[model samples]
Target chain A: MITRVDHIGIACRDLAASIAFYERTYGFSVFHQEVNEQQGVKEAMLRINGTDDGGSTYLQLLEPLHAESPIAKFLERNGEGVHHVAFGTADVVAETEAITGTGVRALYEQPRHGTFGSSINFLHPKDCQGILTELVQSPVHE
Target chain B: MITRVDHIGIACRDLAASIAFYERTYGFSVFHQEVNEQQGVKEAMLRINGTDDGGSTYLQLLEPLHAESPIAKFLERNGEGVHHVAFGTADVVAETEAITGTGVRALYEQPRHGTFGSSINFLHPKDCQGILTELVQSPVHE
Candidate 1:
């Protein structure tokens, strides 16, 4: 079983520029912004209109802050915009097992730390239908 | 102004296999499925939970039935899972104009035929931050 959308991840070369764009153009407000050194990314969570308290889904803007970061490579090859969609899952291992049983590849052999303190794993885009799928298991509440 | 998520596009290599995975694992039901010869894609709509009926949010699974399809190229470069996130806008023309003014390239200069017959325009991923974005305007009277 799965819950709602956790976050929509976007890879950007400049967080400030993209942040300004969403704020000025769409009125989306940044709820939280942090740098995950482990993941080599600086991310900002922008709440969608009318969901400021994290009650509704949010936009995650990721800026690689480093040269060799995967985000940078992604930008170099694909350019900017929708990177991945993180979905809330009841059980990451079970869901991943289910997916792998179908002979699809999981990005991580096991679960890994995700953006915003969420436990997440990326299902290989090849395993999925061409979209990079993130399986997120959030804290039992919220 | 924006409402909520319109849908996430998933580019699949196999329409039938992806459909079965989403339906069985995620509990999504098919809203609509079709083959668009011009687009070179076979698309299937999966209703994301909590957004049913005229629900604005859903997932569009797209399989490049032809090798020359753009979706096919996306698959070749990026693999699969989540392609783009569509946002529901109050005014498509206004939004398109605003975004275009910001230097974000629109796949089409104007809204065009979309899944489920919605008026939609795609923003070039290059300008937005490595993530593909879509703007959707529903025909249903508000």
Candidate 2:
């Protein structure tokens, strides 16, 4: 089942500039950064000021690396803004079933590789009232 | 300075329907609800799965009550989606000064009344790269 908001994703053409802005203005520091080849974006996760046990609601900024990627399409149409929201889940399989049972389809047949090596699935924005939602099964560090 | 992500504001046409969707799917519960004539919207703040001490990143679902309000105009143009994001701060006045010094503009000359009766101000979407951003000094609740 869905638990907490993991991170809110923002799409930007210039990820470095966006990072500088958050750091300078909001004091958000980059705790994690990764480039997912499959997702076609460079990702940066900003650490917010709650959750002491490595669990916190953070901001994920995505800079499209390819023209045909989903985030690229989003930026082409909407410029730059919130791209999607990710929620934490313990069992993604059960969560996938639960979400699809409500007639909202996941973008993947199953969870795909996501940031921090987590398995994730995206719920179409059209079904979620224009807010693209994602469910993520936290990565096991082993 | 900004601390945590207070909540992500979503513009929806039906507050009840959006609330139901969140409750049924994510198990989020409404922690606060209010109608602010000044903002011309009915707002619902849903508590997420973390933080027991009244500190958690929540979702603020907004339904426009009047046709001429800023949110109504947003819905009329962008359809339904994430409208803005609120960053938490200890002092609204100080934070506002810091943000404005960066060449960004706030929607209000001074922080105005907001959800949960908090002092709040919005940074123009153009300045924030298409994301309408808000700074909120959470209520003391005394």
Candidate 3:
């Protein structure tokens, strides 16, 4: 079962610049920052207002560090913007099955390791009517 | 201060078909439906996991009812997909002012009426890195 919105991912060419824009303009505060060497990108998470439990959810901005990163490709094709919206789900595999059963293409046949230690899968935007949907299993903090 | 994510708006060609697809595929239920003639859209709100307290906001499918509707133009240009991600705000006017003062383009000079009796103002996707951002005021119950 899928639940509330987890976060909206935005891909940008310059992570620092975009973060400055969001923070200065929207009052969004940076929660954390990291560089994913495998994805070849640096990311910053921003906490927006309205979080009930210390703002457990936030938006992620990704800046590709290399030309071969998928984020780079997405930025090149679609430009800097929303990459995907992540939804917290109980069973990503089941949700993928459910969505794929409707003839929507699932980018991943099974859930893969997601950022912040979550299990996630991607559904192609073509099948999702142009909005890339990502299903993520929220990480349980010990 | 806006904190948590409120809801994501998806622009669909057919609201009924989209609603049926979401319900049948994802087990979401339609909680509310309304047509904002001024915005030129018939919107159907589907609750995720049947939460009705507005904690987990539903997916809003927008179907443009007129040729000149802004949604219709969006569809024609961008095709069917996620239109905007609305962040719930306690003071939309203040948020709008803050957002616009950043030198980013806002689609509306002032907050306009939105479906479900909420006030909303749109920030241009060009300014927001291709992701349309909407500042939505708290819902007014009838």
Candidate 4:
């Protein structure tokens, strides 16, 4: 069901500052950047190493666009830190159905738009041992 | 400095249960399991996607060996969830020196023995935007 460990999302107070820290400290370069009003997050995807393998992973830095955004609320409760771990999937709908069939809940009834035109749905953290998990089906997969 | 996102350390209450959950829910299988007394953790590394790429990622499920273990203390305070994010490096010593040179503190003055003969060191979370970061030099790299 899962293809790879897609990305780890990190919530930050400032997008540019966090980006600078990762780039300077770990030599990561931002591969893509976008703002999603629906999610209320300004995000940057940093490629970990220069690999372009089918399973290339990333560190996603997220800053809230508003106080009402989920990322903002997460920062308020947990401070700046990891927000979620996303797994790459070839078919998120099937994967969601298969997992939720086992009684675990999905955050959405249908897959939602994610970064880089990916389709994503989240698994409830309570059921995932306190770790919020996202299943992402990239545009290539679709 | 860093080669890849090596693994995400998830602090779990029970090693077997967590292993079963990941294997059953996400089709992940345990690739390696070890007990590290120095780290006070019984850990299982589940290979994500079975890619075997140079940058193959993993979900590291960690269970505390004793009540005084750092993982146990983390569970008592934060419950079961991600404990740290490890980045792969060819030379942990050089990576530690470079990162700490920027004023970020490494948890150990020297690299310590890690799972599977990897040398590892941790960075202070306070300086990493509240994310506990680990630098791992795998035996292959060493």
Find the candidate with the highest TM-score and give its number: 4
Question: Candidate 2: lDDT of A26?
Answer: 72
Q: Model 4 over residues B8-53: C-alpha lDDT tens digits?
A: 9999999999999997888789999999999999999997743333
Q: By summed lDDT, which 10 consecutive residues of candidate 1 chain B come out lowest?
A: B47-56
**Candidate 3 lDDT tens digits, B1-142:** 5644667788899887788777766677888899898889999887543222235455789999998998999899878877888877767888888777778777887789986788888888888877788878866521
List the DockQ of the predictions in order: 0.39, 0.57, 0.49, 0.60
lDDT of each: 0.75, 0.84, 0.76, 0.89
Clash totals, every prediction:
17, 0, 8, 0
Model 3 chain B worst lDDT window (10 residues): B48-57
Off by over 4 Å in 1: A49-55, A65-68, A76-81, A90-94, A97-111, B37-40, B51-54, B65-69, B72-82, B140-142
Model 1: per-residue Cα lDDT at residue B8: 82
Ranking by TM-score: 4, 2, 3, 1
State the lDDT of candidate 1 residue by residue for A26-59, as single tens digits. 6678998999887789999886533222235668
Mind giving the per-residue lDDT tens digits that candidate 3 earns over A4-122? 56678989998889988888777788987888786678999886533222225569899998999999999888788788877767678888888888788888766777777778898
Docking quality category of candidate 4 according to DockQ thresholds: medium
User: Comparing candidate 1 with candidate 2, which one achieves the higher TM-score?
Assistant: 2
Measured by DockQ, the strongest candidate is 4
Stretches > 4 Å off in candidate 2 = A52-54, A140-142, B50-54, B140-142
On the 0 to 100 scale, the lDDT of residue A136 in model 1 is: 81
Error in Å for residue B136 of model 4: 0.4
**lDDT string, candidate 4, A1-142, tens digits:** 7877889999999999999998878878899999988789999999774333365678999999999999999999999999999988788999999999887899999999999999999999999999999999888534
